[model samples]
Target: MANVNDKYAIRMMKADDYEQAFVLWNGLEGLGLSEADSPERIARFLQRNEGLSFVCEYEGSLIGTIMAGHDSRRGFLYHLGVATAHRGQGIAPLLVNEALSALLREGIDKCHLFVMEHNEAGQRFWSANGWEKRDGILLYSRGLESRGLE
Candidate 1:
């Protein structure tokens, strides 16, 4: 693993980054996610909603990624993952800041993300970054498999 400054930089993703981004995406714990994920799904998602994905590159290779989207209700954060070798170096916050900047510029006042209920590390990271837990709102998911999207 390379030093953080020497190895990684964050930037808006390009069309050609889909394959590399997919590799990073597959490594995440939860992201509609699995290591066997197909690039086609990622491509299709980005094509439908461009400017919602960003990648972090290390030594010219994709090592991290974040996906964000918004509706009338609130902005959603997704796929905010850093590669195993790139953890603990403040990369994720940069990616989140980039996404939040875009959303803020678009007039989004409230943004929300879901971490697995058991993920204490995730909770701590978000809290340290100034994200507070919404007191009463529960996140309920309708499984894609139940809807046959799996």
Candidate 2:
């Protein structure tokens, strides 16, 4: 699992890693989701999605993670986060690049992710990484309490 960096390793996450990944994931203010995380919710999220997750380990500790999933038409990104302590160490882009490469390899030519309008820093990071922003596209969602969905 060691790379040339020697201090960091990147690989697919396993079931056992979910606990650490959960703590690392929740500490970040990404994904624009409303509900708080619990092990049960994390497990349910994994059940409903089919994709790959890559975790970045530095010095044997989990530092960052990214997940990629695709519907028939396009690839979507979710829950990309780097622990506060891991920021500025070139870990974020590494996680992102790995997910992007995986999507391309899976026959996905187009990929998209949702960033809250208020999350300027996250938007900047995506733009700086060469991901295009599409104008005039609006997102709508129905919560579990929504009439029809439930």
Candidate 3:
């Protein structure tokens, strides 16, 4: 563990960062981690959606991470997390803003992120940041491969 007072920098997440970043996300309670998060898949994601993902480095240790990307018209955010000891110091918003900023630069106007229904902390974070929870909307997804991608 490194001191928060130490030098810190936020930069794009490289492929090599997959292992450590995966560990960090899995350690967090609310994040849904799965085998699909393997390094190969993450690398493919970063390759297609570069510059929208980032990690926070403190004394060479990864202390935070966020992933944002857009599908031409709208942006989506995911896996925004900061270390337990790093909360309440304004790092989370910084990470979210950076990702959102990147998406904005990509010509995306509207953005959305999914928070588990039970993730009160995440809801508060978004709400406090002026994000309104949409009413009567739902997020649905399915595996492309299951539909015949593979």
Candidate 4:
């Protein structure tokens, strides 16, 4: 765990955090937001994943967030973001560690996260923090027509 000052507190992310977390992620340049990020969806995710997501707050305002979940095999992380003013304060790593720790507790050993192809800063951050950039694999996605809440 990274040592954060008394002014900052890290805790499990709850449904009530959606509004502030959405604003924080929207202000960030590289995070992709979609209908999957709607309040109802996020609330459901939090309910499904339970303790896997986390947030860092400075004096009661959220400044960082990381969401993690597993498919009963490998874990995946999403939407790791720290406020611009708090970028260099180790908040991001702290959030990542918290999520990873939670995943570990749930018996998940391996984890993955996607960084946008153009997000050099995000790439650098992940690499510098000991995450490997995998080769010889490609991500394929197909969007199905929305039924109701998907």
Candidate 5:
């Protein structure tokens, strides 16, 4: 697939694109992908929050992706990535805006995303896009079974 003009098309991330998307995620540094990021889980997410996640394709190849979903309380973003060759081409913001638009259509106003401290590249990407890093904030997690939140 040769998109010599650096133009890419954005679309909803379908189950069929999981393999390509997963490979793209693996190639990017500092994305905390896990077993929960498997094809089945992603399919379930897209099913539950239709139109809230997107992938950018260049000449039929998945080159960028952003995952967004809301629990009717707050929206969360995850695993946004752009191929190295396409980094400076403004693909990431396009993908993000698409997802944010979908979330807003659902009446969501506040959205949040997690970025690793050491991920300077990812941090810069978010910062450049107008995201603020909140001080005095920390995140904690645990298995549902362990926490009885299941």
Candidate 6:
């Protein structure tokens, strides 16, 4: 909740928020967005993880966002970003706290997030916020072809 006199508010993110959130994320450095972030995909994500994602609004404009979801065991967070002008105003953490709190309410006990190897600022932010970095863990990925495994 924002103070009555403040110009900012925090709330759960809705599907309609995708456009604004995409613009904010695309403009931010160290954020790696791809086709996976398409509007349809984001909308689907919000539906599957309802009430777990959040956004921050300031003066009627979106200034921050955090997307969260879970696999019935561990929660994962993504796309956390704050407008450049809104940095240092504690908006990022507020968005994060909102997502984390929602995850907790869903009975998620542990959480994880990824930072690009080159994103120094992002790494620092997570470290400063009490998130531990896991060492010796490798992440692997594979892309499925449209007609594979038929």
lDDT for every model? 0.75, 0.74, 0.83, 0.93, 0.87, 0.91
Clashing pairs counted in every model: 0, 0, 0, 0, 0, 0
Candidate order by lDDT, decreasing, is 4, 6, 5, 3, 1, 2
Q: Let me know the TM-score candidate 5 reaches against the reference structure.
A: 0.91
Candidate 3 is scored at a TM of 0.89
Model 2 bad stretches (over 4 Å): 1-4, 30-41, 44-51, 144-150
Q: What is the TM-score of each candidate against the true structure?
A: 0.77, 0.81, 0.89, 0.93, 0.91, 0.95
- Judging by lDDT against the true structure, name the best candidate: 4
Give every collision pair in model 4: none
What global local distance difference test value does model 5 have? 0.87
Per-residue alpha-carbon lDDT of model 2 for 1-150, expressed as tens digits? 324277878887655677888778667775454463566665665555534567888888888878777785798887788888768878878887787787788788888987877878899999998988999988876666656764
Candidate 1 residue pairs in backbone clash: none
Candidate 5, 48-140: lDDT as tens digits = 988888988988899999999999988999989999998888888888888898899999999999997789999988998899998898898
Candidate 4 stretches with Cα past 4 Å from truth are 1-3, 146-150
Q: What are the per-residue Cα lDDT tens digits for candidate 3 across 55-113? A: 88877888899988788988999889898877887778778878888998999999999
At residue 134, candidate 5 shows an lDDT of 89
Winning model by TM-score: 6
lDDT of 6: 0.91
What is candidate 6's CA lDDT for residue 9?
89
**Per-residue lDDT tens digits of candidate 1, residues 1-150?**
223486687877666787777777666664456432356766666665567667888888988887777885688887788887889888898889888887777788789887777767777888999999888887664545567665
Give the residue spans of candidate 5 off by over 4 A.
1-6, 145-150
> lDDT at 132 for candidate 6?
98
* Candidate 3 error regions (>4 Å): 1-6, 146-150
Give the clashing pairs for model 2: none
